[model samples]
Target: MPLILDALCLARDDAPVRRLIDALGTEPVETTERRIGEPAVLSQHLLFGSGGEIVLHDDAVVAVILHLAPTPSAPRGLDAAEWLPGVDNDATFADFKATFDVPWRFADGDRYFVLEAAYLRPEFVKHGGRRAGDLQRVAFTVDDPRETCRPADEDCPVCRELIVRTGDGSFDLDGTVDALVAGVEAGVLKESSGAVSLADLRLLHASALMERVESQVTCTACGRVACLTLYRDAPPTFGYHPLDAAMRRPLEAIPPVEEWGDAARIAEVRDAMRYVDHEPGLWFLVEQHGDLYLDSRYTISSMADDSCLIRLDEAERQEYHEAGRDSLTELARRIDRSGPHREASPFHRRNLLRHPDEGRDYSAEVRAAIAGHTWLARQKQAAAQRAQAGSAADG
Candidate 1:
C-alpha cells in the first residue's frame, strides 16, 4: 500500500509534505505520521541569564520566537509573571512541558519547534504492561535540570540541596568566602576523614551562601504587616520565635540565635524550608539531590564566580513571599483565558469545546492544565490567607 492510506492522515499542504518527506527520507512514520503522541521533542526559547546555573533537559534549548496569535487580547509581549497561580515546575514543567505547551521566553532569531521528551509516557506505560487499575503517571515537560541535563522520571534531592546550598542555604548567610582555604584547614576545620587536607574543604565551600535574618510579610489585602524573627527549625520556630503569635504580644524572647551555633542552627532552618507549603513561585524544585542542590531552569552551582546571600532585613522576606504569592495568583488568571481555546479532534475523549474537524491539537491539554493550575492556586492562596487572617484576628 502507498503512504497516506491509514485513515488518520491529518490535512496538509503539498509543499510542506514534500519538505517533510525529504527530511524523513523513506521512513514509514516520518512519511506518514498521524498520532498525537509521536516521538518528538517539544522545544521553546528562554532568556538565558548571564549568571547562575541553568541546565535544560536535553541541552536542546532553542529560541521561542512567539508571534502573537493576532488578536486584540493576544499577549503582546512575554510576561510569564502575569499568569497567576502558576503550575508547580514538576506537574506541568516536569514531563509535561513540550512543544505542545506554551513557552515562557523566546530567542531573538529563530522560530521554535517541538521534539520528544526522549522518553514518552505512552511508550513507558505501554512497556509496563496492561494493569489498568494502577494510577497512570504521564510526564509532560520535564524541569530544566542543571546536572542531569536530560529528563528522567526520578528525583535528585542532592541536586535540590546543591542549588539551595549554592544559592544561600537560608537567610543566615555569613558573607560567602572562598577563603582561599579548605573548609577543613587553611580555614579552621577538619574533614570527617580527618585525613583530608584543609585545601580539599575549600572545594566544597565553593558554593554560594546566604544568612538567616529577621523578616516579615505584609498582607496585600488588609495592608497589615507582621513582624517576626527568622528561626532555625519550624515555621513556628521561626515566626513565633518570640512566642508572640501564641501570646499575641511581643515580650522577652525565649531562645535566641546567639545561643545556637550559627552553622548548625542555619542547617536546621534550611532543612525546614524544603517543607514550607507557601504560595508557589515561578522558580521551583524540578529535581532534588539529597536536600542540597535543587535543579531548576534558573538555578545553578556550576560556575567560577562568587556572590554573597545578602542578609535580608525584616521587609525583604515579606516582600519576597508577597511577590511569590502574586506570581502564583496571577498565574491563576491565565487559566481563565484557556477556556476559549479549541480542542483536538471530535474523536478525542473528554474534550469540552466544539470540534473544528481539523484534527487533534493542544487545546484540550493546555486548557486542562490551566484549569487545574487555577484550582490548585486558589485553594492554596485561600488557605494561606485564612491562616494569616485568623492569626491577625486573634491578636
Candidate 2:
C-alpha cells in the first residue's frame, strides 16, 4: 500500500508547473492530455513521474499528488503525522500556493491533513491513487476578512476590536484571532470555529455587530458600512409625520418638468403645476389654473371636464398618428379652439386607462399616492375643525 498526499490549489499561471517539476525533483515519465469528469467534461493535463502525479487545467494546479515509497524494514505505509508538518511550513506552503494561484487570499494558509478512504474512488484516480486508505487531503482558500480589509480614514470600533495590525503593516493573525475570541467572549461577535465556511463566519460576525449600532457606521479598517440596528433597548421616541404628496410620488410616475432650451426650465414648469396624479399606466399633471395634461402612454392629451380637448403638442399628435391610432388623431384634430372649457374632472372619480404592454405592478405607487391624498385631506379637515371651534367660541 502506498501513502498519498493530495493538495488542491489555485495557480496564477502555468509557471507553477515548472515550480512543481523542480520541487518534485523528478522528470515526467509520461505526459498526456485527458478530458476528465462526466456531464461537464474538463480538459486537464496529467503528468506521471516517479515522485507522483500532477493535474493541471486553466492555469490552476487542480491537484498535486505525492506518492511515498514503502521501505521493507518499516511499516507498509509512511507515517501520516510525520509528513503533515512538512507541508504546513512557510517554504512548503508558499510553493503549494504558487501551483494553485486561484485568485483568492487565503487566511492562515496552513495545510490540514485528514485520512479518508474516498481518495481511492475511481472519479479521483486521475490525480493519482492506490488501494490504500492512508490518504491525506488538504485545501487552501483566500476567504478571510483580515486578508481582504484595507486601511480606512476613520477606524470602525468593531473592526479595530477584531483586527490587529503588525509592525510590517501586515495583519497579525494570532493577535487578530485573540481579538476575535475576546469579541465572542464579550458578546459583541458570534462564536464560530472548525469546519464553518468562511462566508458563513463573516455573516455571523456582521449580524452580531449590526444588532448593537443605531446609525450607519463605516469601518475605518475595511471601509464596510453597517446600517441595520436589529436590537434596541426601547422603541424610538418621535412623532411620525407623513411626507407630502409630491415627495411621496414614485419616480416612475413623475414626468420630467423641463422646457427644452431654457436654463431654469424644470423649475419654471414645476412652479406652474399644482400637483400630479397617477394610476396604473397613466399619469396627469394638473396646472395651477386646473387644466390637465394627461399621458395615456399612447397619447399625450390636454383635457377638461372629462373631455379630451386637444393633443398637447405636434410631437404628441405625430406619435398617435404613427401608432395607427386614427380615432385619437381625429379627436385631436376635431377639438374646437373655442373661448371657454369646463373644469377638469376629479382625479379620483375619473376612469383610469392602462397601456397594452405595461405589465409592471403599480399597486405600491397607487397606494403611496392614496396615502398622500388621505394625509392631505386629514390636514384640511383638522384646520376646518379648528377654525369652526374658534368661531363658535367668539360668538
Candidate 3:
C-alpha cells in the first residue's frame, strides 16, 4: 500500500525538491483561476519551522507555496477554508474569533487554526532547550476577539488587550496559531506526505536558509523599506544590492519563535523579507555609498527570469539619482555621448542638435563635415528621383 504524503515547495525556484515533488506524484502543476484571463495560481508550498505562532495567531511562520509544472504560475491565493469549516460561519478575523473547543487543534498557538489534533512526540524547542514536555498534542486558533473586546478608550486591535492586528491588517491573536488548527480540523491543512523527519528539520534549520544583501534602502516618504531588484545595468559594478525597504530591525513586539539555527541569521532574513512586498515580479533599488544596485534575486515568482524587470518606487528613483547621477538630463547626455555618439562621423552626428547661438560646444570640422554629408546625401536622393521620373516619361 502507498503511504499518504504531504506537499510543500522545495526550493520554489527552478528546482522543486525532487522528493517533495515526487511525493505529489510528479503531477504537472495544475493552475486554477477564479476568473478567466486572470493569472492561474500554483499551490506547491515550501514549509519551514514548526507551523504556528507563539501568541497564538497573527501569521509569523514563513511558508511559501508556488507553481511547479506548466512553467511556473502565480498562486491562486484562495484556500478551502475561508474560516474554519470552509470560510462561511467563521468569526471575523477583522474583529471576529473562532473557537478551538476541546479535541481542537493546537490551541496554545494557532488561529483560524487548522488541525483539531496532532502530536509531535518528544518535542524540543527550535534550539536545544527546556523540553516543552513530550510534545504531546496541542490546539490553537484565531479566537474571536468579540468576547475579549470591550469599550476601552482605544478599542482597536492594537490597543485591545486580547486582540492584535495581523500582517494582513486584521485584528487577531499575535500570530495565525489559530488559523493552522482551523485548516487541519476543516480538512484543508493536510500533513506533508514527504514529511521531513525531526532529525532532518534540525539539520536543515542549522544551514543558512537564504542569501542576504549587505546593503538596502528605504522610502523616505512612506517609511517603507525597499528590497533588492535586478537590472542589466546597476551600480556597484553592475550587480544587485539590498534596498532599504528590505532592511528590518529587531521586532520588539512580534512574538519570537524558539527554533534552531543561528537566530541572528533568521532574524536578519526575516527583517529583509518583512519590508519586501513579496508580490510576484516585484524588484527594488539598492542604495549604498553614492551607488545604486539591483538584486537579481528570485523571490516568490513562479518563473523568475534571471533577467527580470522591476517596478520602481520613489525611494529607488532617488537612490539612482544620487548614486548613478542619473536624472533625465544626465541620462540623455549619456545616451547621446556614450551609446550613439561615440564617433564624430557625419553619419552619426547624433539626434540632439546643439544650437550655435546657445554656445554649446561643438567641433567646427565635425559640423562642417556633417553639413557637407547632408547636402551630398540629399542631392543623391533627389537625382535618383529625377532619373526615375525621366525613365517613366520615356517609357
After aligning candidate 3 to the native by TM-score, how far in Å is the CA of 237 from where it should be?
A: 14
Q: What is the TM-score of each candidate against the true structure?
A: 0.15, 0.19, 0.17
Candidate 3: RMSD over Cα atoms? 28.3
* Candidate 2 residue lDDT tens string, 19-74: 55644444555554532211112334333343345555444554444444432222
lDDT of 1: 0.24
* lDDT, residue 250, candidate 1: 30
Better of 1 and 3 by TM-score: 3
Ranking by TM-score: 2, 3, 1
Best candidate, TM-score: 2
Best by lDDT: 2
Q: Per-residue lDDT for 104 in model 2?
A: 26
Candidate 2 segments exceeding 4 Å error: 1-13, 37-41, 48-50, 69-83, 86-395
Q: Which residue runs of candidate 3 sit more than 4 Å off their true CA positions?
A: 1-62, 65-79, 82-91, 94-215, 219-224, 227-395
Poorest 10 consecutive residues by lDDT, candidate 3? 236-245
Indicate the residue-level lDDT of 106 in model 2.
16
